[model samples]
Target: MSEIDRNQGLARQIAKNIQDSIMQGRLSAAQRLPSEVELAERFSVSQPTVREAMKILAAKKLIQSKRGPKGGVFVSPPSLDIAAQTLHETTNWLVSLGAVGLADIVGARRSLGRLSIAAACEHAEREDHKRIEAALLELDHTEISDEDFCRLEVEFHQAVAAACPNSLLRLVMVMVNEALIPAANMISFPFRQRDKVVAMQRQVFSAILVRDAAEAISAFDTLIDYQSGIYDIALEQRTLGSRLR
Candidate 1:
């Protein structure tokens, strides 16, 4: 490989090493990484190479630099929002590049959503149930535009996922929601159709409230199947439009 390629590969390797350390809990969140000079010495690499590796880590938001004299790279603290955004952007990129498709996203959401809903049914307290109900009520408002309604739809799902006892499962739900946003935006649900969607959500909520896992999963499956049909129509429309162009 060329020198530049070699440097790029080295930087990636260094970044992976740090990422593994973080994942293995050897590098705690918010902990300062060794200085560039120290890292270069330890890795037997040039300071510039170490800086390049640090840049890779920073771009991934794995490590951030501080300002002032005490400035240094530190592991990024755990952030659900940040993680969700990263997953959203990465998923979008893959979809745009045709590396992943709507069906793959739909399948993932269907599987993960069922798990989250089941867990929520088992673990959600009355207050958690209230939050889900509130979001659903907000979604039922007739005056909201399609855009506003779509936003509420996502929020309602997120609220349900929040009731899950497992944080990791909740994060997966967030990622799935983010991945599905593009598909959701492609189909414009009429006001009447939105009402039907709200009814489906209500069914899911009702099942969860009663701790009926089978009913909840079945309702969720029906909801996903309904949405997936919309996605299929949207994809077909896009294909036809491209052919016409």
Candidate 2:
């Protein structure tokens, strides 16, 4: 093998070793890693190889680098945004490949939405309420475009998800919302439909504000049912257009 190939292999091995250490809790979050020269000495490799390995770990978000004194490579802390983004990307890929369908997405959303409502009702604080209220206020503006309305809809759901105490559940809710919101925007919303959507949002918010789990769940179901109906219509139209073609 060429010298370059050998260096690449060594770098991958070094990166794997560090990843294993991080995953197995041998290295804790924010723990600084050895300098390039130190790691090169320990791994019996050149400094360039160790630097390449560090780059790999950085791309995986397993480690971070700093510039100044007191600055070096450190294990990255766990991040909900990163986890949710990964999940969203994977879910979108599945939908594109026809491995997951609109029905499946809707079903998952319905199930998760109920759970979020229950948790939010129990654990929502003043800040969470304020976020939901802010989204609702923007949504109530009748002059807003459908694009703005859809964006606020996402903000509103995310605010509710933020109110949930379980980090894992919140992460999953973020993934589901990210996948569903774009699909939801494909259906054109007439003025009447937009008003209905806003009314349902109000119902859900009111129930949440009062910490009423049952009412919130009911309101959520109504909202999901309305959305599902519109999605079904959009799918049918698309299918029919293809048939005509």
Candidate 3:
């Protein structure tokens, strides 16, 4: 076997290696890692390299540090819920700035939505299926208000994106979902059509559950088309205002 290189960027390498171990659970949560000197010796690198690696891990939230003799680097765990919330809040800020609008939101949604649909079709497990179905259940309950229902719709999409097992896609959805919250809320869901809407949602979940990619995409298109009426209302308001002035 070849010896570890010390003259190179060993610190980054060490950081990534430890990060993988932490993410993979090879290092349990709150467990202290090896000392920098020990790792430097093991990797045949300088102590500074090991220290740099630890800093990288800290930046990524993969590890936390402490002081004194008892203190050391500790592993951090993955959290999808927290990740999703970050995505949502950041995306919302982008929208509020006019950095993106409804049309852009719709386009991005369609693309990401298709990707999730395809993945969900191929990889949806029992838990994923339950999550998709649960959204519909909450929508069905009479206590859900219009604003809350719209938020839930975005949450449903974001949740499905999370199940795609792709972190980047989930992050993108987080921003997109937050940015679209206003437009999402403006989409009028006629109370009489609630059942139909819920049924369409079920169909999307069903397609994913069965691994039917085409069906999933088609169902999403159908659902989105119904929701697009919200945009039409906006156009109508703009036109009426122009005539009045």
lDDT of 2 by residue, 114-227 (tens): 999899999999999999999899998889987888888889999999999899999999988887676556553532387788899889989998999999999999988888
The worst-scoring run of ten residues by lDDT in candidate 3 lies at 183-192
* Candidate 1, 1-245: lDDT as tens digits: 99888888887888889999999999999999999889888888888888899998888888988999988889999988788788878777777778877778778888888999999889999899989999998999889988788788888889899998887787778877756754455453531377778999999999999999999999999988887787777767778989999
Question: What RMSD value applies to candidate 3?
Answer: 8.7
Give the better candidate number (1 or 2) by TM-score.
2
Model 3 steric clash total: 2
Which structure among the candidates has the greatest lDDT?
2
lDDT of 2 at 72: 96
Cα lDDT, all candidates? 0.84, 0.88, 0.73
Model with the higher lDDT, candidate 1 or 3: 1
Q: 1 or 2, which is superior by lDDT?
A: 2
What clash pairs does model 1 have? none
Task: List the candidates ranked by TM-score, beginning with the highest.
Answer: 2, 1, 3
State candidate 3's TM-score. Answer: 0.62
Runs with alpha carbons beyond 4 Å of true place in candidate 2: 187-192
